[model samples]
Target chain A: MENTTKDYSHIKGWGIDADPKNDPTYPMKRRTNEEHLGYSWERPTLQPQTVEILHSNERPNVTAVFGTSTPPSGLSGMIRRLAFKKTENDYGHWLPLILADRINVVEGIIEDLRSGHVPNIFAEKGYKAEWKYNRGGLLRKAAVAAILSYGVVAYFRAKKKRKHNY
Target chain B: MLAMNYRGPLRVRASQKPMPKIEHPQDAIVRVTRSCICGSDLHLYNGSVPDTRVGMTFGHEFTGIVEEVGSEVTKIKVGDHVLVPFNIACGQCAFCKQELYGNCHESNPQATAVGGIFGYSHTAGGYNGGQAEYARVPYANVGPTIIPEGMDPDDAVLLTDVVPTGYQAAEMGGIQKGDTVVVFGAGPVGIMAAKCSWLFGAGRVIIIDQVDYRLEFARNYAQCEAYNFNEIGDPVLFLKKETDWMGADVCIDAVGAEAAGNAMQTITGRKLLLQAGSATAVHWAINSVKKGGIISIVGVYGPTDNLIPIGNVLNKGLTIRANQASVKRLLPRLIEHVQNGVLNPKGLITHRIPLEEVSDAYRIFSEKLDNCIKPILISPSAGL
Candidate 1:
């Protein structure tokens, strides 16, 4: 005689399977689990996944990848080449004032000192603010800044004069 | 590759369709040999069941030869003659394990209204049915049973659905010895239910229907007293008078949606689609059965709510047991009955049309043309 009694161990009441291992397509079926069967509206048990910070969050507390051996190219490369001097350990790239206007070079240097990043110019030789110090690099930088600021003011002044005359 | 295409309500045409291929590791493609147009398919034909998508094929009761098996399909092999159950059950599911194969979870992606039924509609799991030359049977190992050698294929196809449904109707009634049973709708299921009721010790069996031929067939086939509801007065009151105003011990509703009789019910349930198929048969069953008697419903209804007389049910203390037949659970005993010559499952088939003429078969069955009781579609390509 055949056994008519059903084995209820694999049965999940209210229309769901307790063990779906036997059916290979169970995972792909739309109504395979208890949640799809309307048995329980409870959310799925949370899986333990590594939580990595997203691009929208605050930047991590590490030196920026600007002045490394393989420098990033394009507009960022041009900006990095001009703005911050290269450091011994490439640690001065996160100097918070890296985004400050180039005309505020003196203020940027002072802010770097407060932020505990010694400017490469000073670290290379000695702490000096005079024009002749560090191969006259400071004087050269000041001359370039003055020329750019005056050239911008004169062009705008010429455009204003033409608008009034017309 | 010719298959029945659902155009709309009362509109269907046979068109060439692409041969179905195995879609899952558990699926097996079966070359359909004998497919029957089920009475429930009428519900789909009349646009009663929601999501009866057009371009869908529509025959559920089918027997075939397995053409190919997937990598994971182990039980059924290629070229094996088999009868596929209407319910697509993943055998390992909780419901399948408990022998409640009709409520299988993984087969039907739709709402839990019903498990997978081939070609019924999306409401019963949008699996395309077996009306075509080839059909993909998912969870192949679980549902398809090899047709025993020497057993006729015609009988095997009906076993897939109609016979089990009818037998389950009788079983659900919980008929005690010598209990009087009244069955509504003299359709195939009703006749089988009446016939099977006798096996369960029913002393008197009465089947009611408006059609003269079906009523006559019921009397001759089931050996039960049959009545035309139109020839008599209200069937409910007639049943009451015959039972000494006490009512029958059990009532089985074999007619679901699209039932005739109450004008209000017909207008609201059938025309307006307001309630689940006309509850006229259900109303009669509830009122005509003896208080505290059982009412077994093997009829198919829509997934939405129906206007049921719950107050009458509560007052009468009636037990209503209704479900899609769990075919696998009842197969063993039903097969024995067939083998013993006690049951003629294929005796109900009245019309046999080729699969290409499936559209006309649906019309004949739907319109009750030529007194067609059941129509079986024969596939020319089915390696009989």
Candidate 2:
């Protein structure tokens, strides 16, 4: 219960808040989120694009991280939004909404897959490959960053060790 | 009432000195019941005000009670609670009739934005400012607002400058129905512009800033989406992705050259490209807006070559409307919204202080303390 419930409630997708910063678990609730109705700020919503992610935790099983026009829905989607907010030290003004939007997209993909809504549901060979490619890309980036960090650390460590010897 | 006393760059110890008054039949005496510092007011403190003089009242953001009427004044009654929009226009003037109060021909027709501004130098009219107990307002019947019964002065006070400036940013930007709008800067005016965009039916309103504290406060309070311009290397690229590869339907230049850094010299010391820096804003506007979209400016500027790509806005078929908001025209509607609770305009006031503490208010607000968006000033203990 590390408060995994995301608070990315500011995101708007598919005609609703669709995200969790508005989720009740967090305090400092933004009272005006709903009050504004945001009539004047509305823009044509983006057509949800579908993508899949094979996020791994401790297991090697597929999480069915389907992508949709909007992000995934529910608390999990809120978590992703919060992750983006985390990037901006104190969370961005639109982080919640953006996070929520990403969540809605994921949720739509998942829902379509579950309901046989996506035409090439299982046979779409590209889905699995895309997921794997995304995972691989992320792994490669992380590995490069880790190697760079270690290289710098090792360089400093070796220099300090040699300085003592000298 | 006395002459329009101002806080000139030259420090005057005459805090007790009387202001000058006008006896023209067209003039009316207004006891300023409410007044607040404007971003332009800092021009004086910052030594940017041109041809400075003494006894000038520096505030342009004000609401007041009509204390006395001139012989020719007929529309406004004494004791009327009115929010004075900054631009002075004679209603009968050709431009005023067309609602172009900034270019009103009857009064100081040469006055920029239709006529003279209170406390501004000879560039506009040398009319006194509103930062005192009393000010003589010209064409009082035309500009003074009658606060409806039971309306809160704080809610309507901004009708003069900040509120309209904010609304004008949204309006003149030509916000399309369900168009995505983004505003750069989250200052009081920026936040109001974001809020007003929503009020104008924007599908999504985004605000960009590097101040984390301000982003947090605005997102939490104003319900706006915030972007970190500092973290985002290419704001335009990121914004395009955020809006499906279409830039903002409208972009507002709330942060003029000063905020953008010294790379962009300030046209004058006035904040962001209000009317003065329209050209500076024009450059960013052309880039931030989608082709055929509009970019509006509300920040103040002084005369200079804007260095804007004039052909771009025209080539893109982008509409550009830059003007100092005619407070007399926009305040009443803003007031009605406040009175009817259609919107909570008061929420914009992030801090409140007593009249004597106004100096502190100026310090904090100017320094942008604690996510200070807008601070309202009340008298010695007017129960603010």
Give candidate 2's root-mean-square deviation (CA, Å).
27.7
Q: After superposition, how far is residue B116 of candidate 1 from its true place, in Å?
A: 0.7
Which candidate should be chosen as best, given lDDT against the real structure? Answer: 1
| Candidate 2 docking band | incorrect
State, as a TM-score between 0 and 1, how close model 2 is to the true structure: 0.63
lDDT by residue for model 1 (B1-384), tens: 877766556656666777877656777899999999988899887877754545568878999899999777889999999999998877665556557788765565434446778887655555678888888887787899999988999999999999999998898888889899999998989999999999999999999988888888889889999998887898889999999999999999999997888899999989987776898888899999999998999888876557878898999998898888888888889889998999998889999888766666776677666677888988778767
- Give the Cα error of residue B49 in candidate 2, in Å: 4.3
The whole-model C-alpha lDDT of candidate 2 against the native structure comes to 0.57
Per residue, candidate 1 scores C-alpha lDDT tens digits across A32-137 of 3333243322211121212210110111211110001011233433444332343312323222112221223344346447978664543212123122223365
Give lDDT: candidate 1, residue B231.
79
Question: What are the per-model DockQ values?
Answer: 0.01, 0.01
- Each candidate structure's TM-score, on Cα atoms with residue i matched to residue i, is 0.71, 0.63
At residue B289, candidate 2 shows an lDDT of 81
